[model samples]
Target: MVAGRSGNTQLVAALDRKASALGLYVGQPLANARAMVPALRVVAEDAPADAKLLARIADWCDRYTPFVALDPPRGLLLDVSGVGHLFDGEQALLDRIRAELRRQGFAVRGAMASTALAARALARHRDGCVVAPGDESKAVAPLPIEALDLDEPATHAFRRAGLKTIGQAAGRKRAELTARFGSRLVYMIDTALARANAPISPRRPLPDYRAERNFAEPVATEDIIRQTLLALAGALSELLEKRGEGARRLEAVFFRADGIVRRIAVEAGAPLREPNAMVRLFHEKLAALADPLDPGFGFDLIRLCADRIGRAEAEAQQLDSDAGRERELRLLVDRLAARFGRDRILAFHPCDTNIPEHAFALLPAQHAGPAERPWKKLRGAKEAPRRPLRLFARPERLGLLRAVDGRYHMRWRNTQRLLTRIEGPERIAMEWWRSAEPTRDYYRVEDENGRRFWLCRDAQSGQWSVQGGFA
Candidate 1:
């Protein structure tokens, strides 16, 4: 689950507080943390688990505010602009959030400021809610320059030259600081102090249109459901047309009186505004739902939202116009995807690699369309020799008999093929430091049917396998 080598090691190093304390004295590399304290233990980090945890927290925070941004490696940013009044006050809200996080076993620090950078810096360097509005400069004036998130070497250089506090650095002439530390330092300072606008980029953009319909009574019939969906789609389509755009991703959420919400998403092959088509698409998706649409004391509300959208293009008409046909084909694919599962419908696209097994990737049909890569021009250029047309996701073992003369012959489906053409003894070594190491000698072979295949012999096990086939 670890993303990179450094991140893996850093997580392990962080857990060893004793070693970290000793290494904090003078100049010490992270690798030397174990040397300072011999019993220090380390393990690879799990980035996927971390990301999943952050995502769950983000979802849970929706009760507070819909505006949440993930701060990778740690933390999340919530914009409680107009919504803070509902929770009594800003401090009360922060305390409640902190208490909830504590109950969930998360050690957290909360801060509020006029700007994001100021909030982040204050939270990192000082106590909870370190700086309030209009007090950023006063709060950050005495903090060390390192709180600015400057690079280690730059910080060290600054400290060596006797500029320790942020106030000292801020006191210097703007031009002199810009010339010495480059624009990045100046920008960070200005952003932190609220002189420049610093924006938070959300992991996913907020949905554009949201429409909710409250029913007088629960409706369990398919006809009623379809009717309601059509109405919502019509409203959404009209809203999109006004903006000169069409919906690409749509979500339909049904909320029952019992508070359970069932949501289904549909993605269009192209931006679409047709209400009938959208309703039909959802019908296809809902038909396959395993959970019954139980009224459960009566349904309350049904909401429709557009997650992604794009500009609508003017249609071109021709005698042999395939646009209509293409639309039908895409709709057919969407229905099939909803029924048989999305992974069943796939497309193959070329990858930038000479290795046959790495030369193509399978992409979902819903997301894959005509790409503009110039494959012919790329193939014509001088580069590594082209690979085969077909490659197995993983090689299949082939039984081979070695002759006394140091040659080999293979048998496939009771048919023997002699070692007539052989091209390589290319050897690849294993990465000893990592898990699941492999070492192989690959070769190109031609059979009596004029077919060519790339094969490899495992150096460690002495087993031969067929990896790929040429066009």
Candidate 2:
């Protein structure tokens, strides 16, 4: 099965052993492939899904080493330097990884070297290779120049100069190579030979506290997994308390046997140190997943980590119940956020704008606590014009408004009513420097039925609209 953009129908990207034996090669046109074998089948390319699967595979590789990085398109880089001895040596670890993936039904190739570039090149080009420390150059010398991953023009120049193998290119003078092909070729050769260096960026942030469990046999039941999480959370809580900090965000990673990884993340509305609270939050997060987690063939390793932390300290007992009430409220917020999503639970924060519509903004509850930004009181008046309990998102237009000798009469919702009382002519001007907007004179008017409405009249147009109503 394969895909390409040569035509609308399809093109070959890969083929099975039978197809290869019958002379079908990758990048061969689909029309040509079908002609070769009438029974050939082709499928559409799902690049995004493939990329996601690749990411999951990278997550699973964390079981081997925390320093796993993506190599893009379809590859991964694992920095197994200090960790390889855990499996009894680099060779044993590589063999174990290969055997596990193969058992999970994937065709895998692996190689190890002192440098990431050399290891990646060998994995893609050579097979079953182990370039011992200080021997990277000798091992990759015989491989083709393509292993350097040079641009096509540079590769063609190298070929034209009769430098076909990496060894031949290595033999040339560095200054001479730079003069002919620019500094890129020189730098690439140095990197491939482990003479130059680069770094691998891990997919996730390194945690402050990490506790992991590796099983002799894979564990599949959800209850058992929860029990593991409970234990890890207990250990993590103790660590956080000793450090005088609390976890604000935590991540639980399950490494399945079949190269699939499932991750559950939970965030706390306030700094959280209780292990039981953390466990409950994770349960809510896992239950809210749109796709139920499946432990296919079971998980071989599970790790718990505190991804985000914050300073926390024990507070003195309050004379009143205010502190207890605040704690309870934050706990409720955390639970609701875990179930309904963080964005779904929000708190209003004041914005630096006078216009009612632009006066405030909503932020996630976990991000914007009640005290994050204090509410600003209107200037000048001790008893300001009472704002409606509920303000309209946009003011509703009124059909007819008339003032009868200081008293008001208005037609609203197909009914005419005489306003018994009127309180304001609060004038608010638009920020003229920002935009051209009409100034408004707002009035609190009470109708015959005693229902009070906030009405705004455009000073320029003399048109009135009902903005909101008091409770």
Candidate 3:
């Protein structure tokens, strides 16, 4: 028996079958139970341990269905809508889940119904029950009002009003229930009767595509693990191809026999559909883990899931072609991103700004979406590029002079430069709302050495500096 503090006295939080049969029940005062049976064994209740154990069981249940939701204290809600046929039927699937959980040393009670409330009520009163569609109200009508899990006072009020069964309470008008028991109670009833829907909040997001392999005997061999991933990737690829989609992010979930789960994820800059390419990314990710994926006591299940999917259609291509080259570069980026951290590998995103330095920002390539603004080509086709290929981190001061014939001369980096020509002073204004920064003018100048430079002049201070250089 597990005892925990309840009010001023200790009460039994839980009990074993033997303790239950000995006339000791949960919520019974521990002192009273000890008085009833002097030799009764007792242990302290561990709420945290219980919660962690439930979480682990939920993770293990991912093998059965991705739509697994926690039902708190000791319940798990699984939405196995289209997957029942895989295990034969609803009854068979229910039996299998319970049997496997029992094998893992858990005493589980489960029921299926059209609604979660109905299922909860049935699981508590009618274990192993599978209510057919639209029969939830009829099925639960005979159970007591306590079946709804009402608080003690509410249950007492219903009993005082001579409503002994669920059918009796549900027969009352909605208005009366609201006036006395409140809307929450009415909602509970409505959901239990399948007249309303209560969506379960799943613990994890549903994957776009999924494939798995379950081994009868646990296997820890790296070769087998690798082969399993390859096969699952192939299966997933087939599914993705049928829908003209590919995975932007893929996760491999390893389920160890001992209820330990390890999930390793890899992301691609572009949609990835090739099985070989997907496997290679996982290889790099697994190899680069600071703490290696430990197959403690071997893994019984291996699942590959495409968490984030993107459009990918078959196209004619050549290895030397531009499209093929782009694909190769994207694949290379994915590999590099997996080896290093995604954040550590960055790409430039164009920002919608006129300031040269603020025009682009570095973001993680794998996660960065389309740029807010596209790169603008400053010069027209067949014309010299307006922006410099290389911009200095900070502008360098320069001495400038104009000759009588309108030619220019400049001294930069302590070297005198005889300019052949100088472009007009293209004016650029500073952001007025932000600061008191002065407006500036820019010029493109070429020296006698056939080198070009982008120079800027301070509008108010009359200071000149070389801002950047052209390649």
Q: Pick the candidate with the highest lDDT.
A: 3
Off by over 4 Å in 3: 5-11, 21-24, 28-44, 352-359, 368-471
Tell me the TM-score of model 1. Answer: 0.50
Full-model lDDT, candidate 3: 0.90
Q: How far off is residue 283 in model 1, in Å?
A: 6.0
lDDT of 2 by residue, 285-402 (tens): 8898899779999988999989889998966645449887887778788988998899999888887767765777889978885554567766467764466756888888886555
User: Pick by TM-score: which candidate is best?
Assistant: 2
In the range 1-471, model 1's lDDT, one tens digit per residue, is 111255334323234335446554322334554456565454555778878888777655644665789876677888888867877988888888888777877777778777777777887887577356677788876788888878888899779979898878888889998999899889888877767768897655667976667777776667777888899999998898888888888888776654455668887767878889888889877777787566676556777889888898655533345877787777787777766677888877776544445546788888888754545332456753446667777788898887788776787657778776778877766555544657778887877666787888888888888888877
Listed in order, each prediction's TM-score against the native is 0.50, 0.85, 0.77
Q: 310, model 3: CA deviation in Å?
A: 1.4
* Cα error, candidate 2, residue 281 (Å): 1.3
Structural RMSD, model 1? 13.5
Worst 10 residues of 3 by lDDT: 352-361
Candidate 2 ranges with C-alpha deviation above 4 Å: 1-3, 6-12, 18-49, 314-325, 356-362, 369-385, 403-407, 414-416
Instruction: Give the 10-residue window scoring lowest on summed lDDT in candidate 2.
Output: 370-379
Higher-ranked by lDDT: 2 or 3 = 3
RMSD of each: 13.5, 3.6, 6.1
